[model samples]
Target: MSLNPIPNQIILLLLESYNLGANINLAILMSLIWNDLFLLFLSVRNIIVFFGPSPTLTKPLRL
Candidate 1:
Protein backbone atom coordinates (compact mmCIF):
# COMPACT_ATOMS: atom_id res chain seq x y z
CA MET A 1 0.00 0.00 0.00
CA SER A 2 1.29 3.45 -0.88
CA LEU A 3 1.64 5.96 1.92
CA ASN A 4 -0.67 8.97 1.89
CA PRO A 5 1.37 12.12 1.33
CA ILE A 6 -1.15 14.64 2.59
CA PRO A 7 0.52 14.99 5.98
CA ASN A 8 3.92 15.28 4.30
CA GLN A 9 2.67 18.07 2.07
CA ILE A 10 1.20 19.86 5.09
CA ILE A 11 4.43 19.53 7.03
CA LEU A 12 6.33 20.96 4.08
CA LEU A 13 3.94 23.89 3.93
CA LEU A 14 4.44 24.59 7.62
CA LEU A 15 8.21 24.40 7.22
CA GLU A 16 8.13 26.77 4.28
CA SER A 17 5.94 29.20 6.20
CA TYR A 18 8.57 29.32 8.94
CA ASN A 19 11.40 30.01 6.53
CA LEU A 20 13.17 33.38 6.87
CA GLY A 21 11.51 36.00 4.63
CA ALA A 22 8.84 33.56 3.40
CA ASN A 23 5.87 35.00 1.54
CA ILE A 24 3.40 33.22 3.87
CA ASN A 25 0.28 33.31 1.66
CA LEU A 26 -2.50 32.58 4.13
CA ALA A 27 -5.19 32.21 1.47
CA ILE A 28 -3.39 29.47 -0.41
CA LEU A 29 -2.29 27.76 2.79
CA MET A 30 -5.74 27.77 4.28
CA SER A 31 -7.25 26.51 1.02
CA LEU A 32 -4.78 23.61 0.91
CA ILE A 33 -5.54 22.62 4.49
CA TRP A 34 -9.28 22.86 3.89
CA ASN A 35 -9.05 20.81 0.73
CA ASP A 36 -7.04 18.07 2.43
CA LEU A 37 -9.46 17.88 5.36
CA PHE A 38 -12.50 17.71 3.08
CA LEU A 39 -10.94 14.89 1.10
CA LEU A 40 -10.02 13.02 4.28
CA PHE A 41 -13.57 13.35 5.56
CA LEU A 42 -14.98 11.93 2.36
CA SER A 43 -12.62 8.95 2.43
CA VAL A 44 -13.43 8.18 6.04
CA ARG A 45 -17.13 8.32 5.32
CA ASN A 46 -16.65 5.95 2.42
CA ILE A 47 -14.76 3.52 4.63
CA ILE A 48 -17.53 3.52 7.20
CA VAL A 49 -20.07 2.80 4.51
CA PHE A 50 -17.94 -0.01 3.12
CA PHE A 51 -17.23 -1.65 6.49
CA GLY A 52 -20.60 -1.06 8.16
CA PRO A 53 -21.15 1.05 11.30
CA SER A 54 -20.66 -1.73 13.86
CA PRO A 55 -16.83 -1.69 13.41
CA THR A 56 -16.49 2.05 13.81
CA LEU A 57 -15.71 3.84 17.06
CA THR A 58 -19.24 5.22 17.46
CA LYS A 59 -20.68 1.78 16.59
CA PRO A 60 -23.97 3.10 15.34
CA LEU A 61 -26.58 0.38 14.85
CA ARG A 62 -26.85 -1.08 11.38
CA LEU A 63 -30.29 -1.24 9.89
Candidate 2:
Protein backbone atom coordinates (compact mmCIF):
# COMPACT_ATOMS: atom_id res chain seq x y z
CA MET A 1 0.00 0.00 0.00
CA SER A 2 1.11 3.59 -0.74
CA LEU A 3 0.43 6.93 0.87
CA ASN A 4 -1.86 9.29 -0.99
CA PRO A 5 -0.35 12.16 -3.01
CA ILE A 6 -2.18 14.98 -1.28
CA PRO A 7 -0.90 13.90 2.15
CA ASN A 8 2.59 13.69 0.71
CA GLN A 9 2.34 17.26 -0.53
CA ILE A 10 1.21 18.39 2.92
CA ILE A 11 4.20 16.74 4.55
CA LEU A 12 6.50 18.58 2.18
CA LEU A 13 4.82 21.87 2.97
CA LEU A 14 5.21 21.23 6.70
CA LEU A 15 8.90 20.44 6.24
CA GLU A 16 9.33 23.68 4.36
CA SER A 17 7.63 25.51 7.20
CA TYR A 18 10.09 24.01 9.68
CA ASN A 19 13.00 25.06 7.45
CA LEU A 20 11.69 28.62 7.40
CA GLY A 21 12.48 28.84 11.14
CA ALA A 22 12.62 32.18 12.97
CA ASN A 23 12.92 34.16 9.73
CA ILE A 24 9.54 32.93 8.60
CA ASN A 25 6.99 35.54 7.57
CA LEU A 26 3.59 35.33 9.27
CA ALA A 27 1.50 35.61 6.12
CA ILE A 28 3.25 32.74 4.36
CA LEU A 29 3.00 30.50 7.41
CA MET A 30 -0.70 31.26 7.80
CA SER A 31 -1.32 30.53 4.14
CA LEU A 32 0.50 27.21 4.35
CA ILE A 33 -1.48 26.23 7.45
CA TRP A 34 -4.74 27.02 5.71
CA ASN A 35 -3.71 25.02 2.65
CA ASP A 36 -2.81 22.04 4.84
CA LEU A 37 -6.16 22.13 6.62
CA PHE A 38 -7.96 22.30 3.28
CA LEU A 39 -6.04 19.30 2.00
CA LEU A 40 -6.84 17.30 5.16
CA PHE A 41 -10.54 18.11 4.89
CA LEU A 42 -10.50 17.10 1.23
CA SER A 43 -8.79 13.79 1.97
CA VAL A 44 -11.37 12.92 4.64
CA ARG A 45 -14.20 13.85 2.31
CA ASN A 46 -12.72 11.62 -0.40
CA ILE A 47 -12.47 8.69 2.00
CA ILE A 48 -16.12 9.06 3.03
CA VAL A 49 -17.22 9.31 -0.58
CA PHE A 50 -15.30 6.19 -1.57
CA PHE A 51 -16.34 4.07 1.42
CA GLY A 52 -19.90 5.31 1.90
CA PRO A 53 -21.59 5.08 5.32
CA SER A 54 -20.96 2.17 7.66
CA PRO A 55 -22.76 -1.10 7.05
CA THR A 56 -25.94 -2.00 8.92
CA LEU A 57 -27.28 -5.52 9.67
CA THR A 58 -28.27 -6.12 6.06
CA LYS A 59 -27.51 -9.61 4.84
CA PRO A 60 -24.39 -10.08 2.78
CA LEU A 61 -24.99 -10.96 -0.85
CA ARG A 62 -23.15 -13.48 -2.96
CA LEU A 63 -21.95 -12.48 -6.37
Candidate 3:
Protein backbone atom coordinates (compact mmCIF):
# COMPACT_ATOMS: atom_id res chain seq x y z
CA MET A 1 0.00 0.00 0.00
CA SER A 2 2.78 2.31 -0.87
CA LEU A 3 2.75 4.80 -3.74
CA ASN A 4 3.84 8.32 -4.34
CA PRO A 5 1.35 10.12 -2.14
CA ILE A 6 1.21 13.01 -4.56
CA PRO A 7 -1.13 11.32 -7.04
CA ASN A 8 -3.35 9.91 -4.32
CA GLN A 9 -3.55 13.29 -2.73
CA ILE A 10 -4.42 14.87 -6.04
CA ILE A 11 -7.14 12.33 -6.76
CA LEU A 12 -8.55 12.74 -3.30
CA LEU A 13 -8.52 16.45 -3.85
CA LEU A 14 -10.43 16.03 -7.10
CA LEU A 15 -12.84 13.49 -5.62
CA GLU A 16 -13.63 15.03 -2.24
CA SER A 17 -11.18 17.79 -1.46
CA TYR A 18 -8.81 15.24 0.13
CA ASN A 19 -9.62 12.74 2.87
CA LEU A 20 -7.10 10.59 4.73
CA GLY A 21 -9.06 7.36 4.80
CA ALA A 22 -9.86 7.42 1.12
CA ASN A 23 -6.22 8.20 0.45
CA ILE A 24 -5.16 5.11 2.39
CA ASN A 25 -7.76 3.00 0.62
CA LEU A 26 -6.50 4.15 -2.76
CA ALA A 27 -2.97 3.22 -1.77
CA ILE A 28 -4.05 -0.29 -0.78
CA LEU A 29 -5.96 -0.68 -4.02
CA MET A 30 -2.99 0.49 -6.07
CA SER A 31 -0.67 -2.04 -4.43
CA LEU A 32 -3.14 -4.89 -4.80
CA ILE A 33 -3.73 -4.05 -8.46
CA TRP A 34 -0.02 -3.85 -9.17
CA ASN A 35 0.69 -7.22 -7.59
CA ASP A 36 -2.15 -8.91 -9.45
CA LEU A 37 -1.65 -7.13 -12.78
CA PHE A 38 2.10 -7.58 -12.76
CA LEU A 39 1.96 -11.36 -12.68
CA LEU A 40 -1.06 -11.46 -14.98
CA PHE A 41 0.50 -9.30 -17.66
CA LEU A 42 3.84 -11.08 -17.40
CA SER A 43 2.26 -14.48 -17.74
CA VAL A 44 0.06 -13.40 -20.61
CA ARG A 45 2.96 -11.80 -22.44
CA ASN A 46 5.08 -14.91 -22.06
CA ILE A 47 2.26 -17.16 -23.15
CA ILE A 48 1.41 -15.06 -26.20
CA VAL A 49 4.92 -14.41 -27.51
CA PHE A 50 7.01 -17.35 -26.43
CA PHE A 51 4.64 -20.21 -25.64
CA GLY A 52 2.03 -19.44 -28.32
CA PRO A 53 -0.95 -19.19 -25.96
CA SER A 54 -1.74 -22.14 -23.70
CA PRO A 55 -4.08 -22.92 -20.86
CA THR A 56 -1.41 -22.25 -18.27
CA LEU A 57 -2.03 -18.53 -18.07
CA THR A 58 -5.72 -18.84 -18.70
CA LYS A 59 -6.46 -20.01 -15.17
CA PRO A 60 -6.44 -16.46 -13.87
CA LEU A 61 -8.25 -15.00 -16.80
CA ARG A 62 -10.79 -12.86 -15.02
CA LEU A 63 -10.67 -10.09 -17.58
Top TM-score: which candidate number?
1
Score candidate 1 by TM-score against the native. Answer: 0.48
In model 3, pairs of residues that clash are: none
TM-score, predicted candidate 3 vs. hidden true structure: 0.45
Rank by lDDT, highest first. Answer: 3, 2, 1
lDDT of 3 by residue, 1-63 (tens): 789999988887877844676889899999999999999999889877986656866678667
What's model 1's lDDT at 3? 75
Would you list the C-alpha lDDT of every candidate in the order shown? 0.82, 0.83, 0.84
- Give every collision pair in model 2: none
Provide the global lDDT of candidate 1 against the true structure. 0.82
lDDT of 3 at 10: 84
- Candidate 2: where is the Cα deviation over 4 Å? 1-24, 56-63
Q: What is the lDDT of residue 9 in candidate 1?
A: 94
Put down candidate 1 lDDT per residue, 1-63, tens digits, no spaces. Answer: 987899989988888767733545666788899999999999999998998777566767689
True lDDT of residue 43, candidate 2: 99
Query: Higher lDDT: candidate 2 or 3?
Result: 3
